[model samples]
Target chain A: MKRKVFVASSIAAALAGCAKITNGLNEWQPAQPILNSAETLNQAIIGTRGTARLYRPGDVTLDYPVNSLDTPHQPEYLSLIESDFTTYRLPVGGLVDHPQTFTLRQLRALATLDQITRHDCVEGWSVVGAWRGLSLGSFLKLVRPKPEARYVVFYSYDHDQSGQQFYGSLNMAQAVHPQTMLALDLNGKPIDAAHGAPVRLRVPTQLGYKSTKWIRNIALVSNFKDIFGGQGGYWEDAGYAWYAGI
Target chain B: MDATAGSSAPLPRARSSEAGVVVRRHSLVTRTTHWVVFIAMIVLTMSGLQIFNAAPYLDASDKSDPARRVLSLDGRTTPAGSVGVTTILGHELTTTHLLGYTDDGQGGETARGFPGWITFPGYQDLAGGRRWHFFFGWVLVLAGAVYLIWGIGRGELSLLILRPSDLPKLWPMQAYYLRLRKEPPDHGKYNPLQKAGYTLVLFVLTPFVIVTGLVLAPGFDAVAQPIVWLLGGRQFARTWHFVAMLAFIGFFFGHVFLVVATGFVNNMRSMILGTYRLGKHEGTGP
Candidate 1:
């Protein structure tokens, strides 16, 4: 009888003790602050300061159009031949046999290729699009790297005024992959400025950011440690996983 | 001897007080179902942890080396065929690729299936998780159903579910509780707070967990498309599933505390044996 009483009282007391949050109405709150001020300021500058360029499929025409800004996805690929943006320059420097800058017409002069692939994002989203551009391998062949060159880094005109280059890197193995193309067209039409126009890197097997839209400069490096944030890409340096593969 | 008989009559009355009062509380079925839930909660929480450890969120230093390999996160090949993989600090590949498979004659190549045996340093593949999770899930659901049925039959459901009176009493009871000035509210089989929690777990959280889990079924996606859409998306469903796990963890600890607080031995015995010690009765006759 005593044991039974002890057990009943003890268990009841235990159940009662489980009620910890006496007030349940006010506990729910946001997990973290919505935005940081510094990040918002940086984003505002990057958003407004770029000239949009349009790129079309199978069109290898590159022009050096002097534009005030070169932001991503500017929907300017269609009116390229008529737009005030007339000149396009491909800057090739850093660890190369020939540090030569090429006109848009010069880039278009190379063998062009097109591929349809999916662009996956780390935030659990994807889109299928067609891309047209010169083979990065062919371009690398033009400006041969010295034996020490191990990685190719692409810099974009999309940058903060602070000279922090928005960049991405690829090992030589992937740079030479047959399908790797520097696309100037998207979705069977001229690449929209809202998308990377002029030219962008399309790496089918990786996430969207790896594609590095609105590319402006190419640098050959022996190692990746010297780059900003040293993680390989712009978004990567800003807390995104560098290899955001599906 | 006639005088001795009179003395014996008084002894019966004193004996009644010593024996204490008996309260018929939890039914046998209720007791059984409660234990089943207790066991299931323990197993589920432990297994869930093992699964979470398989894929953790990335940190800054995690972008360098060692950590990335351990986390099994690598870069996807771009359409350009460029493979830009990240090397995080502390992410070194010690184990061979365990989750990879090569497709067999379908559209693409298949890889080896996950090893069936339980071993450390091996990936906890979806197969193993599904096996244990599904098996225990059935047990949990069945036990819950039985509990509900038994509760209704015994009219214990009314006692366990909150009534209109419980709302007004909830605040005062809570204040008394926070101050530790009053013992637990004494009414029927369960207090208002206990009823509310159990009801929420049964009606809201558990059902959502079970339904979302079903949506993850491979071929069942087509059939469960409506549910998936209603929940926003598959990823959203997964997020809710994780959130539900947190709720269950809270419920589990709370349940244990209540068990220990309310006459541990007596409650445990009643749950296991379906009997409570008899106490003195002031007015009622047995």
Candidate 2:
């Protein structure tokens, strides 16, 4: 009886350990912050001021894969798409000194930059395409964000099977990076529905997921602690790296 | 029949004639790092396969093209049913129930790059895979760093480093393994072939895998761009990473075979307990 009990307890303890490990697989740990910081520092060490033209134009993949293509049938998104996104207004609010809601036309009127860059997906595929839009740095200058605003959160209309909406955010350094853009056009044409039509966050220096699509709201926030899932982005909430520079 | 002159350093003469004497074979640090690296590699390799399932293709250029792809896994539907296909170097193979399609750890079969049994978590979870991969990746790097520093500081690296003079003894060692020679020539501490294998894995394959992996990281791209260019490009680096993984797997199998063939119990004891019972003969190994 003693030996049997000991064996039973050992099996139970092993099962408990396995459960803990599985649960901790996606658990938010303190080391993530340190890792993110280290990654950011590595980028800085390489002097990637985001000015370097990385990919050649000839290498651009004309037929870029459209990810997160499942459009939410939300009423707001449906109405916006019906209007051809013409009446769409991007509200930039929260920790910014000057709150503004710019129409697509107004966004187009801002200082725009067109560059052919590589889009590296986290899944190990790379696609090169030309993106035309206002440089996020120039757009930030116009918005005049408060010094306390450390992150720019872009809200999307897409969601997962669990009905959780898709969203992503970038730190102030990444938000103001020269290659970061609020893209209005892809492949020298107006953005199509499959590719985040009205506006998309195009961050060439990071993974493709960091570049959110169908951006409806832009909020400057001090931190992402109170945000949905509190992990900075949909994929990040699902346990991907928030920095995503890799 | 006798020890090769061009082999490594001289071995200590056995003091016993019957029951072999026990001797210290490994340091505490060596044993610790060896086990740590062994565990970390298993986790990294499985999780890496899980991550690879996300794209299931290896390209040779900056962008993925059908023509330039080195390896690809795809699914197809025929009148018979859906079948998983794996293509490599222009040759196609139906890898149904395995490579391109397999169980999802649930009863249901799914289309994936590698089989579920071989993947970490044994399901489709790229996000989870990346988390496991990065965490263990750091563990491997730290363990590797400790081992490297300790090896260099203690001059243990010389035991694995092959010299020009050791080349002649490699064939004799191979012949011993093939049973073409009756007695294994003494090669002190490590045989010439063992030295060559360890040197290739430590100094060549491991570093190549690491550099290629670093090249895949976008944050490190700026610094690693020149290295990437020298190796062809980003996609080539990615392909080479997978190739290096295969080579590591091959080395692992060969290493295990040798451990078992030469002296399983003694070798295991030496690695685990830091001590080995030497054979009656002075030149006999652990």
Candidate 3:
């Protein structure tokens, strides 16, 4: 009881001086200043504590929409023209020794595998899809990233609700995980425009936001401080955790 | 098998009420856990509603769009009537100015489930709302663990569990609640309804929410995949989580109403001070 009272008093005292953790713009986040840092401390703890997670093999989705695709055009994406994307080149810049660009066909020609995994979203929904692509680890080896590169940022042609350019970032560790892929095919078929056509990043271990849907550039940087808005991803830029393992 | 099977003192249900005798009704541990769970429940509910507002509703599709939101709950937010529709019970809440779906104040429609008034942070940040929900999630989880461990250590948990004999008393308890009986059965501190409610909240609902919640977390996906498959799928699990929150809201309000209805001061005093007056109307003071 004494302990409880002490703890309660401490929390009450802390709350007495509450300030808005975030008052800027994020589409899906609450605008209430009272709720800004409410969960940030908690998320930080979870993010720091549970950095690694295991991926269990699961069956393919039994249905669609709820089971497969979550979005098509809600966040605006600029699809390169058929001819432009046919010869599309993904610029691999940032802290890399062998800065290179690979066309969609070249990326598809590399060693690849099909992975059927569940896509978990922070918005309280998930779906299973068979994603086929070249392993990010393999791609990283080809580019030969510099030792200083600690994070990977994927730029998207997609626009958020507020018309800002969409982007997502990941720790280099997650960026090169075996399950991480630059997906070109979904469910044994060439990826369509509705999805991130041509190619997209797929990191099964992270939330959907971390998996950037449009293929344009892969920048290996020491930190995301230099990226647009610098929150890591478009969602992260708003109010999401930079490392969304959960 | 029973940790404290022989150590617990039986509740004195038949103690005489002469001179308005008082009895030790609640233990310090139970009281603390109850209040902590109450606070956690409120935070979890509000944060949950905030998250739900982002999507506002659910739809199952194989070729689902890769957009932010294609469908939304329609209210006045949509044009005079733009075929915007959503449902809670069997009734479709498609009319303007309905609960959850409302005008975004910009001419354009937005399907935010609940207003800022009731949700945590009173804003649309799904990320922040999730953080708040998870913070209290651990509180609820830890408090529940302590309750199980301590309740079993003291053998008090058996008091809340439904027994075969409780079936026969169900009718009588309902009659008492309905005011059909003269007085409540000489229940030991907690009436039958209280026992049932407590048992459901502690044993059934709490575990259900925690397990379903675990399934929702991406980190637990591997370890809990089988459980997720068993429950159906990830979306099904989310739907269950939402349903459980509603059930919790119902339980919370019902619990409060009962406490207030059955002599609020006495009930509060028992949970707070440990000593409770002998009868429903034994003492004016708690």
Candidate topping DockQ: 2
Q: Is candidate 2 or candidate 3 better by lDDT?
A: 2
- For every prediction, compared with the true complex, DockQ reads 0.01, 0.29, 0.20
Model 2 residue B50 CA deviation in Å: 0.4
**TM-score (chain B only), all candidates:** 0.63, 0.89, 0.80
Name every residue pair that clashes in candidate 2.
none
lDDT of 3 by residue, B38-124 (tens): 888877887787777766664322212323232345444444544445664335656443354543323233456664545665556
Global fold similarity of model 3 (TM-score): 0.73
Candidate 3 interface RMS? 7.5
Sorting all predicted structures by lDDT, with the top scorer first, yields 2, 3, 1
Cα lDDT, model 2, residue B63: 62
Question: Model 2, residue A150: displacement in angstroms?
Answer: 1.0
Ranking by DockQ: 2, 3, 1
Q: Write the per-residue lDDT of candidate 2 for residues B97-183, one digit (tens) a residue.
A: 777876554445777788666676566778777767776777777888998898787666766688887788889879978999875
Superposed model 2: Cα runs more than 4 Å off: A1-53, B1-21, B278-286
Docking outcome class, model 3: incorrect
Q: Please write out the lDDT profile of model 1 over residues B203-243, one tens digit for every residue.
A: 88889877765443322333344675676544445445656
RMSD to truth, every model: 22.6, 6.7, 9.5
Residue-level lDDT of model 1, residues A1-246, one tens digit each, is 999999987964543332221111012223111212222332332222211111233322222122223563223333452463356677888889988888766766773786654343433223345667788888898888888998889987566556576688877766776667888766656565656667778775444567776777899999877688887777666544443331
> What does the interface RMSD come to for each candidate?
19.8, 4.6, 7.5
On the 0 to 100 scale, the lDDT of residue B207 in model 1 is 94
